[model samples]
Target: MLKTLASYIQEYKVPSFKAMFYVTLEVIMEVLIPYLMSDLVDKGIANGNMNIILKTGLFMILASIFSLIAGALGGKYASIASCGFAKNLRKAEYKQIQDFSFSDIDLFSTGSLITRLTTDVTNIQNTYMAIIRACVRSPLMLIFALFMTFKINSKLAFVFVFAILFLSIVLYFVSTRVHPKFKKMFSKIDCMNSSVQENITGIRVVKSFVREDHEREKFSHTSDEVFSLQRKAEKLLILNSPAMQFSVYVSILLISWFGAHLIVSDSMTTGELLSMFTYTINILMSLMMLSMNIVMLTMSISSAQRIAQVINHKSTLTSPVNGATKIENGTIDFENVYFNYGHADEGYVLENFSVHIDSGSTLGVLGATGSSKSSFVQLIPRLYDVLSGSVKVAGKDVREYDLKTLRDNVAMVLQKNVLFSGTIKENMRWGNENATDEEIMEACRLAQADEFIQKMPDKYDTYIEQGGSNVSGGQRQRLCIARALLKKPKILILDDSTSAVDTKTDALIRNAFMEKIPDTTRIIISQRISSIQDADKILVIDDGKVLALGNHEELLKTCTQYKETYEAQQKGGDFDEQ
Candidate 1:
C-alpha cells in the first residue's frame, strides 16, 4: 500500500524534501537555544560579567528568529506537497474507474467507491501532511534535546531514557488496539453513505408512500453503527494522552530531585540544572507529538489500504493486442452464447442464446421481466463478455475489436433514462460532440422530442437539472432517444426506452427511424405487443431461451405465447386497432 501511494507523489518530491530540510534546520536552532541560555547563567551571570550575558542573550534571540522562519517555510511546503499528492490520487482513482467494465464495477458499490474517494482520501491527506511536518520535526527535536541533556549532565538524561521506553510501550499498545476499530469504522461509513444516498435519490418515493419515518429509522441505524465504531476507536486513542502526561511528569520530577543533590555535591551547577529542566520538557513534548502522529498514522494505514485497493484493481476485460479498428456494418450475430453475471456455477442469465441480425433491419424483442433481454443486447457492445461462444458485430468478434471502436458503432438507450446536469443542447452533444444545431434538431424531430423542447421557455438551450428531474418522464425518454439518434450509430438498441411516451408517440418515433435512418439496424425491446407488431421480425424470449422467432402475423398463427399476449393486450384496451 505504501509503495502504491508513493507512486502518486510524482511532481511533489522536491517540495516534500525541502519541507523536511527546513524542519531539520528549525529543530537544530531550537535545540541550541537552551544550551546557550545555560552558558549565560553559569559563566556570564555568576561571574558578574554583563558583556557575556548580553552576547549570549543576543545569540539566543537570533536562534529563535531563524527557528520561526524555518518553521513557517516548512509548513507552507508541506501543505503544497500533501494537497498536490491528494489531487493526483483522486485523478488516478477516477481514471481507473472510467476504465472498468460493467462486471468490474459490480464488485464494488457506488457508496463504497464514493467513501474511498472522499473520506478515505481526506484521512490519508491529513496523515501525509503530519508526516512531512510533525513527523520530521518531532523525532529530530527528541534526538537533539536528548544530546543536549547528556552534554549538560548524563545522570538526568538516563531518567529520560526510562520515560521514553514507557511511553513507547503505551503508544504501541494503544495503536494496536485502535487499528482494527478504525478499519471497521470506515466500512460502517460506507454503509451510512449508502443509506443516505438511497434515501435522497428515492425521496420522492418515500414521500408518495408516506415512508419517511421508515427511511429515517433505516438511516439512524446505519448512522448509529458508525458512531458506535468511532467511539470505540476514540476510546482507545484517549488513553494516549494520560499515559504521555504521566511519563512526562515523572521524568520532570526525577530530574529536579536528582539535580538538587548533584548541585550540592558540585557535580552540576544551578544553570546546568535549569537547562536540564528545559531539556526535559522539550524531550517529553516531542514524545507527545510523536504519539499523536502515531495515532493518526494508525488510522491512515486503514485508509491507505482501502485507497490502494481501488487504485490497484485491474479490469477483468482487456482489448486484444492488435484489435480491429473498423466495423463493416450494423450486423450482429450471437453464436451459441452463454453468459452469467457472476461465476458459471451461479447459473446463466443468457444460456445458449443465438441470433443473427442483418444490416439495416429492425428486430423487435419481447420478453418477461427476467428473460435476460438487456443481458442479451449488452453482449453486443461487450459490456459483459459471454462465458462461452462468440458474440460478433460486423463479422468480427467483439473482443477482437478495440473497445472504443465497437461501442461507438453501437448506441444503446437503456431501460432507465438518465440525463446529466446541463442544457438540453449539452446533453444531446454527448451523442456527437461535433453535432451542429441543425443536426441536433433533425435527430430530436425524428425522436418526436422537438415539439416539447420548443414548448419550453429556452427550447434546446434550456438547462436540464441533474438526472433531468425538471422534465417529465415522457420528455426524459424522448430526449434520451434524440441523444442516441444524434450518434447515428450503425446499430441502435432501445431497451424499453419508449415506455414512458404514449403509444402514438412511440409509433411515430419508430416510423421516423424507418424514413430518416433506413440503413441503421434498430432493435427494440418492449413489453407491449403493439410496439413490435409492425417490425420485420419479432422474437419471443422466456427463461433465457427463444420460444418464437418470426414476424408478428407468423408468430400469432403458430405460437401460443405470442397469440395469447397479443389477444390479452387487444382486449384490455382495444390496442389492436392502432
Candidate 2:
C-alpha cells in the first residue's frame, strides 16, 4: 500500500528530500547549542573568564539562529511536497474512476467513491506532511541528543536509553490497541456518508412520504457509531501523554540523583550535569513528537489502504487495440445473447435473447417490471457486455468496435432521464458539442421540447437546476430526448423515456422521429401498449425470455399477453389513438 501511494509523489520528490535535508541541518544546530552551553558554564562561568564566556555565548546564539532558519525552510518544503502529492493522488483516483466500467461502479457506491476521493485523500495528505517533517525531525533529534549525552557522560546516557525503551513499549501497546478502532471508525464514516448522500438525493421522496424523522434517525445512528469508535480509539491514545510525562520526570530525577554523587566524588563537573539535563529534555521532547507522529500513522494506515483500493483497481472493460471505429448502419442483432450483471449465480438478465432488426426500422418493446427491457437496449451501445454469445451492430460484434465509436453512433435515453445543471444550450451541447443553435432547435422540435423551451424567458439560455429540478417530469424527459436527438445517432433508443409525457405529446415525438429521421432505427420501450402499437415490430418479453414477437396486428391475433395489455390500456383510457 505504501508503494502504491508513493508513486503519486512523482514531482514532489525534490520537496520531500529538501524537507528532510533542512530538518537534518536544524537538528545539527540544535545539538551544537546544548554542547556549547556546557562549555560556556564549566570554563567561562566557573573560572570567571569573561573572554571565554563571551566567545561561547556568541557561538550558541549563532547555532540558535541557524536552527530557526533551517526549521522555517523545512516547514515550507514539507507543505509544498504534501499538497502537491495530494493533488497528484486525487487526480489519479478520479481518472481511474473515469476508466471504470459499469460493473466496477456497481461494486462501489456513489457515496463511497466520493468519500475515497475526498475524505480518504485528505487523511493521506495530512499523514504525508507529518511523515516528511516530524518523522525526520524527531528521530534525528533524538539520535543527536543521545549522542551528545553519551559523549558528555556515558553513565548518565544510560538513563536516557532506559527511558526510551520504556516509552517505546508503552507506545507499541497504545498503537496496537488504537489502530483497529480507528480502522473501524473510518469504515463507519463511509457508511455515514452513504446514508447522507442517499437522503439528500431522495429528500423530495422523504418529504412526500413524511419520512424526514426516519432519515434523521438513520443518519444519527451512523454518526453515533462513528463517534463511539473514535472515542474508544482516543481513550487508548490518551495513554501517550501520561506515559511521556512519567518518562520525562523519572529520567530527570534519576539523572539529578546520580549526578550529585558523581559531583561529590569529583568525577563529573557541574556544567556537564547541567548539560545532561538539557539533553534529557531534548531526547524526551523528541520522543513526544515521535509518539504524536505514530498516532497519525496509525490513523492514516487505514486511510492509505482505502485509497490504495481505488488506485490499484483495474477496470474489467477496456477497448480493443486497433479496434474498428466505423459503424456501417443502425442494424442491430442479438444472436443467442446471454447476460447477467456479471454475477453468474444470479441467473441471466437477458437469456439467449435472439432477435434481428433491419436498418432504419422501428421496433417496439413491451414488458412488465423486472423484464430486463432496459438491459436489452443497453447492450446496443455496449454499456454492458454479454456473458455468452455476442451482441452485434452493423454486422459485427460490439466488442470489435472502439467503445467510444460504438456509443457515439447509438444514443440512449434511459428510464431515469437525467440532466446536469447548466444553461439549456449547454445541456443540449452534451449531445453534440459542436451543434449550432439552428441544429439544436431542430432536434428539440423533433423531441417536442422546443415549444416549452421557447416559453421560458431565457429560452435556450435558461438555467437548469441541478438534476434538472427546475423542470417538470415531462419537460425533463423531453429535454433528455432532445439531447439524444442532437447526437444524430444511427440508432436512437427510448427506454420508457416518455412515460411522463401525455399520449398526445408522446405521439407527436414518435411522429417526428418517423417523419424527420426515418432512417434512424428507433426502439421504444413502454409499459402502456398504446405507446408502441404503431411500430413495425413489437416484442413482448418476460423473465429475460421472449413471450411473443410480431407486428401490432399479428400480435393482437396471436399473442395473449400483447392482446390483454392493449385491451386493458384501451379500457383504462391510456390513449385516444384509434
Candidate 3:
C-alpha cells in the first residue's frame, strides 16, 4: 500500500520537493522567532540594557512578520501540490476504468468504485496537505526546540527527553489499536457508500413498489455500522491525547521542582531556567502536531490501498501487438467456440457454439434469459474471449486486430437502452464524432426517430433527461438505433433492442436497415417470433444449446420449441401485423 502511494507521490515529486523547501523555510522562520524572543527576555531585559532590548525586540518582531509571510506562501504551495496530485490520481483511475474490460467491472460494484474514486482520493489529498504543512514543520520544531533547550540548560533538557520517550510509547500503543480500527472504518465507508448509491439510484422503483421503508432500513443499518466503527476508532485513538497531556504536566512539574533547586544552588540562572521551560513546552506542542499528522497519514494510507486495488487490476482483454486499423465488411465466424466467464473450470455460457455470419447477412437469435443470445453476438467484438475456440472477424482472429478497430466496426444496441442528459444530436454524435447535420438526419430517418424527434420544440436538438426518461420506451429505443446508424458500422447487433417499439415502427426500422445497410452484417436477438420472422437465418437456443438453426419458416416446421413459441404468440393475437 505504501509503495503504491509512493508511486503517486513520485508523479508530483518536483512540486512536492518545492513545497517541502517552502515548508522548511517556514519552519526555520517559526523556530528562529522563538529563539530571538527568548534572547530578548533572558539577555536584554534581565541585563537592564535599553539598546539590547530595543535591538532584540525589533529583531523578534521582524522575524515574526517574516514567518507569517512564509506561512501564507507555503500554504499556497501546499494547496497546489496536494490538489494537483489528487486531480491526477482521479484522472488516472478514470482512465484505468475505461481500459478495464467487462470482467473488471464485474469484480467491483459501481458504488464501491465511486467511493474509491471520490472519497479515497479526498483522503489522500487531505493527508498530503497535512504532511506539507504540519508533518514537516512539527519534526523541525521539535528538533530545533530540543537543541535550544540544551543550549539554555542541559539539566532541564534531560527532563524534556524523558517526556518524549514516554509520549512515544503511549502513542505507539494507541496507534497499534487505532490502525486496525481505521482499516475497518474505511471498509465500512465503502459499504455505506454502496448502500446509499444503490438506494438513491433505484429510489423511484423503491417508491413505486412501496420498498422505501425497507431501503431506508437497509441504509440505516449500513450507516449505523459506519458510525459505530468511527466512534470506536476515534475513542481508541483519542486516549493518546489525555495520556500525553498528563505526562507532559507531570514532566513540567518535575522541571519546575528541579529548576528551583538549581536556582537556589546557583547552578542555573533564573533567566536561563525560564527559557528552558519555554523550549520544553514547544517540544511537547510539536509532538502533539506529529501525533495528529500520523493519524491523518494512517487514514490516507488505508484509502490509497483501496484505490490502488482498482488502478492495478489488469484486464484480460488487451490490444493486439500488430493490430489492424479497420475491419473489412463484418464477416464473423465462431469455430467450435466454448467460453465461460472467470475460471474455465466453471460452467460455460457457450459450449461448442459454432456459427458463421457473413457480410450483408442477417442472423436472428431466439433464446430464454441466460441462454447466451446476447453473449453470442458479444463475441463478434471480443467483449469476452472464447475459452476453447477461435473467433474470427473478416477471416482473421479477433485477437489479431486492434481492439478499438474491432469494436468500432461492430455496434451493439443493448437491451437496456440508455441516453445521457444532452441534446439528441449530441448523443447521436457519440456514435460518429465527424457526423454532420445531413448524416445525423439520414440516420434518424433510417431509425424512424425523425417523426417523434421533430415533434419536440427543438426537434433533433431537443434536450433529453437522463436515461431519456422524458421520452416513451419506444422513442428511446429508436434513438439508440439512430445513434448506432450514425456510426455506419459494418455490423450491428440489436440485442432485444426493438422490444419496446410497435410493430409498425419496427417494420419501418427493418425496412430502413434493408435499404440503408444493404451490405452490413446484422444480428438480431428477440423474444418475439415476428421480430425474427423476416431474417435470412434464425437460431433457436434452449438450455445454452442451439435447438435449431434455419430460416424462420423452416424452424416453425422442424423445431418443436420454435413452433411452440410461434403458436403461443399467435394465440395472444398481439403478433398481428400493423
Best by TM-score: 1
lDDT of 2 at 210: 100
| Each prediction's RMSD to truth | 1.4, 1.7, 1.8
**How do all models score by TM-score?**
0.98, 0.97, 0.96
Off by over 4 Å in 3: 1-14, 343-346, 575-578
TM-score, cand. 2: 0.97
Clashing pairs in 3: none
Candidate 2 residue runs with Cα over 4 Å from true position: 575-578
Q: Rank by lDDT, descending? A: 2, 1, 3
Summed backbone clashes in each candidate are 0, 0, 0
Runs off by more than 4 Å, candidate 1 = 343-345, 574-578
lDDT of 2 by residue, 1-578 (tens): 98999999999999999999999999999988878888999999999999999999999999999999999999999999999999998999999999888888888777778888898888888889999899998999999999999898898799988899999999999999888998888788888989998888888999999999999999999999999999899888999999999999999999999999999999899989888999889999999999999999998898899889989998877888989999899998999989999777898999989999888999999999999999999888888889889988889999999889988999999768789999999999999999999999999999899999999999999999999999999999999999999999999999999998999999999999999999999999999877898998998989998888899999999998888888887787764344
Clashing pairs in 2: none
lDDT of 1 by residue, 1-578 (tens): 99999999999999999999999999999999989988999989999899999999999999999999999999999999999999998998899989888877778777888898999899988999999999999999999999999888887799999999999999999999999999998998888888888888888999999999999898889889989989988888888889988988888788889989999999999999888888888899999999999999999999999899999999878877879988889998989988898876778888888888999999999988998899988889888898898999888899999988888889999768799999999999999999999999999999999999999999999999998899998899999999999888999999999888888899999999999999999999998988889888998888888788999989999989889988998888634334
Between prediction 2 and prediction 3, the one with superior lDDT is 2
lDDT digits (tens) for residues 406-440 of candidate 3 = 88888999878799999998999989989999899
